[model samples]
Target chain A: MPSSEEVFEKVQAALMDALGVDDDEVTPEATMVGDLGAESIDFLDIVFKLEKAFGINIPREELFPDDILTNSSYVKDGTVTADGISELKARLPWADLSKFEKNPRVQNFGNLLTVNDLCRYVESKL
Target chain B: MRWFWIDRFEEFVVGKQATALKNVTYSEEPIDDYLPGRPHYPHSLIIEGMAQTGGILIAQMQDFHPKVVLAKIGKAEFNSIVVPGDQLRMTAKLMSLQSDGAIIEGHVTVNHQPLAEMELAFGILDDSFGDTSFFLPGGFFRILRSLRLFEVARHEDGSPIQIPDYMLEAVRQEAAQ
Candidate 1:
């Protein structure tokens, strides 16, 4: 299996390729929709890439989060600490954490989580 | 085929107006995936079909060069379930289009009754495919199609929409004369 870092790189590359843009368009500090510019369909396309890259199925339920995957600062104090999903399920109700996979609208379809956040979460599981 | 997701085109002309049709059938695998005994059209697939039809209309204006990716579905309302043996009336209107992409409010209807509706957006999938190095058999398309996630009729309308002069010229130049 590939490392989470590798997976994140793949996801980032996928976004740039699918959206027909460059890495500059989706910087770590850029929001998926605002700064980088992604609508819902574009969002769905991104999800497909993540699923393919990790060879994993994204629980559909996490498709959309109200304030997730936004263009936010992930780097703090000369290191990358702040991230997207941090705001996605930050208020998780526990039991619903497992249910997050079933809701496609959660965290705005994992938009808040950079490839790094996603790899971090996935790595923690391993 | 691996790809990414982009955003709505602020200048997309289909802001809220479009017209087309969707011919449904039992052969669609997604129906069986959701309900075997009572096969019904999955809502997402329905939207994907409509988005394809709408995206094609938008792309035709560019003479099949511009790759318009469906960005989002906004304000979708479902009145009832769709199944095989249904001819859907699909329509989409441009709400806006950015230099990078566009957004359109779209929907489908059966027997003149609204079945599904949404505000959809589309963006350009960059030159990633051209790079080839990132290309891989992701198997994502197969899985998605199995669930009826995507269905594009193998046909070409061959009609071009009115586009800006430069785009038309570019397509003409690309055309094999």
Candidate 2:
């Protein structure tokens, strides 16, 4: 049971190791895809480094999850409905989405993921 | 006996994972027989390509001293079809490694589109299994050399892998010929 600070350090290190980015680019608010420039391919590399660094098994599905936006149960129109927002909130509790909650789009859900979110997820797993 | 599935490896990290790429071409013999009119790469062969990508990684993890065999395919699901002219990028990651064997999880994609996913298990045949020629055929080494696999491969800590003696011998012998 490592402290949150410890987890944050490991997470930052994993990101740096996987993406080869500078130390300054890995702030907690940095989004993996946006700020860190993580493509879909980098996700596997990131997960692998995290698993090795923390000695914890991180399933790919648990991290990004399936694109539930395509399923009718969550999305009725192009925009995410109340049910969809609830599902997103439940799935991504670590994300700070007060801004996203105002108007959520199915496609933009990926944008909500953040570096802090990853650290929080790791903490929860521990 | 002959390795044909894996064309080359793009990335290989010893004891960690590997990413290999195979090009599905109509010039291949199997394509002539598979689906007469609408030619498509066999899903089975695609899976085999993934197996080779992972199998080689698993074997190399232990320096290829033990015989590695595909014991089982725990799961494989094809999401889309692969046709000629498409390049398949297959990545295999070590799930678990133990004394007896190893488990690997693999995924294949074409131009970033998901093609298939698989979970494979491999058995490492130890010396007690009887007189086993763990050394691969000379031709296999030739293919590996052509692909420059050794040049790109690295240990988990990013250090260069010391090419095994038998492999070096085979390469040396093949080069002399």
Candidate 3:
């Protein structure tokens, strides 16, 4: 298994290619969407690149829980309910959802994924 | 105004790679209209040509059932300009394939000299896009026949690829109508 630094490097390169962002812009704190300007389509490209780079299979739901975010049972008045937060936490143990938990608007969820979170997820897979 | 950017398939391997030809000429309106005096093939059209070649390669893997569309261009780089009289050989190789989408690495060359290189992604549209079809029934099969895809196409096992029964059935239904 690659070290954490090596995993970050590969993840950074994947983001640079998938998002057309500069190396410096892919800092761990950078948000995948808001900071790097990644659209919904870009996630697919990123997944393809990461899978090739790491030689790991990434199920779509593991990284992008679109089904949970869109599920009516988990959302109320456009905000994720407390149960939704619990589900997200269970699904994404590597992600830092504390910030999102304060105001879990479904729209804000798109911008919640940070570069560090991605690195952690990749590490967990490794 | 036919939307065909590729003229013919020079080589085709099922679910693998395909090579197509596109000849640029001065008579085509885009050659002159795009830049007035440049008289060269637009890079966008070259990308489209590559996309079509790659799209067909992906579509054929599923017997052309999926509504394959060019979802994103990951990378495109042109090293030289292609003017009129240039016969471009565009090749697309399947790099990755999945149920939701596929990625192709494409290259364009003229006389063995590199012209452009690209990475393109194609998405398989699902039922959410609606039941509307992108083409009339059996329309694409006719287009494929005219492009001579089957003449050069073969399965990985070296067996010749045959038109799917559904396409032949659609053609018969259309002929009756």
- DockQ: which candidate is best? 3
lDDT of 3 by residue, B13-69 (tens): 999899999988888889998888668889999999999999999988888778899
lDDT at A77 for candidate 1?
34
List residue ranges in candidate 3 displaced over 4 A. A70-84
Quantify how close model 1 is to the true structure by its C-alpha RMSD in Å.
17.4
TM-score of chain B of each: 0.61, 0.89, 0.96
**Who is ahead in lDDT, 2 or 3?**
3
State which candidate has the highest lDDT.
3
Candidate order by DockQ, highest to lowest? 3, 1, 2
Docking class of 1: incorrect
Q: What DockQ does candidate 3 score? A: 0.51
Question: What TM-score goes with each of the models?
Answer: 0.41, 0.55, 0.89
The TM-score, computed over Cα atoms with residue i paired to residue i, of candidate 2 is: 0.55
How is the predicted docking of candidate 3 categorized under the CAPRI scheme? Answer: medium
Q: Which structure is stronger by TM-score: 1 or 2?
A: 2
Model 3: per-residue lDDT, tens digit, A1-126? 999899999999999999889999999999999999998778888988999999998988999898899999999999999999999999999999999998899999999999999999998998
For A1-126, candidate 2 gives per-residue lDDT tens digits of 999999999999888866778889999999888799886546655676678788888765577645667778877777778887777678877777786777777667677778888999888788
Best by the TM-score measure? 3
DockQ of 2: 0.02
Q: What is the TM-score of chain B in candidate 3?
A: 0.96
